[model samples]
Target chain A: MALRRTCLAAAVLLALPAVPAAALPPGDAQRGQAIYERCQACHSLARNRSGPRHCGLLGREAASVAGFSYSRALRESGIVWTAASLDRFLANPFKAVPGTRMGYAGVKDPQERADLIAFLAAAGPCPE
Target chain B: MRDTITSLPRRSFLTAGARSTLSAGAVLLLAGCGGNKAAMAAAPEDDINILNAALGAEQEAIAAYQLGAESGLLTKPVLDLAVQFQGHHKEHAEVLAKTVRDLGGAAVEPLARYDFPSGDLKSEADVLRFAAGLEKGAVSAYLGAVPLFAERELAKAAASILGDEAMHWAVLRGALGENPVPVAFVS
Candidate 1:
């Protein structure tokens, strides 16, 4: 019962509808640019490759892209891409959104994750 | 079922139960267990039905873990997580049951005694492998539902659980000398 309670507490904290403020330092988009190289292997701003393109990722509901074949978990996650969500997810992809198909293990460092999200938020839309 | 859930704080109960897993033992347990077919068997079109299906999957996982734990195949880390995983499933079931009931749907009652096949328990490694497979299936199950829920909240909740299942899969896979995360995409 004690174990059960602890686990429940953790999950509830994760599920709470309203997100708190960003915990890490404000992101450095320039630093994030350097960090995005790893992500660029599979993700790009304009076109989908092995992973879905990252163009205009901020404020988007996960897996809302028209043609990409996102995993059901991503489509159903119901998370809007806010800074807090992105930082948490980038730090640990599987933990933030379990069963996600995205291959990246996670960023691990808080600052790097913030920077990455900063870069993503600034990625803007693909050229028509 | 209603009584079991009402006693605890709902959010905590559900999340904790998510920690538990019914695992492969469910597949094994399904060989003989039974439920109130009429009340629990939900309609295909029902939004609650999807939850029921997920609940059923979690129940199966609980039985598997219970059987494995009692069989004494696991020691130290494995045993601890197996029990923890079972607790997670219990939370999942508890939360789903309440959600259905709150929405004017029947809660699916789990079988009284899921007959888990005994011979499958040979070694700790074997137990881990079985658990890993269960976690993997769980990931797939939740993944499939991501696009099916009419409400975005339901999808998010299911996705959250799927993430936990995926985490379990990775740990078990790594323990068994397999590549825990073999692919970029989880599917």
Candidate 2:
């Protein structure tokens, strides 16, 4: 009887759906805009400051800006900006790109990182 | 030359001054008891070690600036700026040394010489770039150190120093005709 019950429980457990690993919280662009104040010190959506412009950061190739100088590490990275890649990069820029010149310590909080990414996604592409 | 490159910002100095004063007061308060009691209340071992590391870096910065100043690689206005930044590092070292002593730790002393890339520092631009790189590293180091302190006040003091270092980096970069503040965050 004990063996039968154990087998039944194992069968039930196998029927459950798998859960995703490290799922990020849903981002709010408005909240992200507020959090972006810290970023304003070096970045702007339309113009480059200390860092590259953010107007079309999402889906943009790393170090593709025409005139801005990029660190060799990033220029050679062959990165295409996406939510997932940006998430990792924004979490820790130094760890993500060893020699990238983005001097930011990175956004440590996941939700904040999500929101900032959302804001960038919503910021629209750079003007032609 | 841009004002940013020619002189330290007044507000940055004022903020550093106020924070240093507060930090000094906190150290004294921590050591208010007699010598034996104060000894018993020393900061955690890790904090002292970290502070000592920061002090060593500050000392190196002082030495590096002195070398640049004496090398005759910098122009008049740029040399003046380097001296001003060196003064800031001196103030930082003084505060760190005092805090270490107040916490019953022996402060780290400056070395007689530092191994800077002397061969590369042939021009004014080269020296400015080297100084800027050091300042940038200092900013990153302080950023990493700020969170590791056992005492919140110590963290705050480190952050204050970090801000000053960032400013120096920015000014040096500007002097080099590069963007003074390239990133929103110091890594």
Candidate 3:
């Protein structure tokens, strides 16, 4: 009886559901990676991050890029960095936040959008 | 100076008229060639084709922007950013069209409608997710095409637009509180 109970408990513990890896919120990372290529012309993934770095971008202050001359709108938007907000801005810069220095059209595909966001989220400054 | 009235022969007058006509014809011909030269240079066969692709991409971008703006989930600042992008797309399209015309080529009409990505877009979060992916696609497409452009002017223009695209991506990522840099370009 004791052996049976121990075996049953172990089985139950093993059957617990595993947490899902950071699922993409909406955008597709593969496509987002490609779309992000255009950005590589002006930014770097490391260091001072000219124009802006893709690494650790989410949740950062809009005016945080040390050497970049950010537009007044982005600098003053007073919006906290978050995945949701980032999606809005990416979808349509003018629609999400007018007068922002960054000018680009929004993404069209929903899944790709989620994937991109998720990728960024996963790559974000590893939760401090 | 003796006042001798020497009436030039009719032949001289006729010859002068012929010379004037010939000069006028030459001027017109040269003008035509000049115009053609400019047109030809603007849209050499390769440039015309490349500009069309760029314009097409811009149109696609515009359509995407319209969809995102309609969602009403974005803030005012974001709205402005989108508008700027829309404007740039429009300008890009116009420039490309002009180049084509200068090159004696027909401008390709933009797509009447575009197919956006679908699925699970039930809320504001859904919309943002969609936007992110779309932006990535645009960026990637442009990057791939950049290497193929021959004119330095076109390349520079594309590069400038691309720089802004990166900024837009970073801003969006920043808003999401995600990492701005997706991949390091450095080896």
Every candidate's lDDT: 0.65, 0.71, 0.53
**What's the candidate order when arranged by decreasing DockQ?**
3, 2, 1
The TM-score leader among the candidates is 2
| Clashing pairs for predicted structure model 2, backbone only | A50-B182, A103-B185, A103-B187, A104-B185
Candidate 2 lDDT by residue in tens digits, B1-187: 1232225455665676744554554454345422223333443655665677678778888988999999988899999999999999998888888887776778877865555667879999999987877787677667766765666557767887888888898999999999887767655
The best candidate by lDDT is 2
TM-score of chain B of 3: 0.65
Expressed as tens digits, the lDDT of each residue in B1-187 for candidate 1 is 2332234355564564443322211221122221222333332234465666577667777887888898787888888988888887787767666666655667666656554445776999988887776677677667756665554445556787888888988998998999999978754
User: Candidate 3 lDDT, tens digit per residue, A45-115?
Assistant: 55322135567878786667665555554565655556656655555554455444333434645465666
- Model 3 Cα lDDT, one tens digit per residue, B1-187: 0111123354553566433332332233223322234433543555555555556566666776777677676678766776766666666656656655655667667665554543455555565555554455446545544544444444444555555556666666766667877677510
Whole-model alpha-carbon lDDT for candidate 3:
0.53
Q: Residue-wise lDDT of candidate 1 within A1-128, one digit each (tens)? A: 65654554456337533435546678888898867755532355775543567887888888887766665556666677778877767765655665455534467677787888888888886666
Output the worst ten-in-a-row residue range by lDDT, candidate 1 chain B.
B23-32
The residue ranges of model 1 lying beyond 4 angstroms of the native Cα positions read: A1-128, B1-45
Model 2 chain B: lowest-lDDT 10 consecutive positions: B32-41
**Model 3 regions more than 4 Å off:** A1-128, B1-43, B118-120
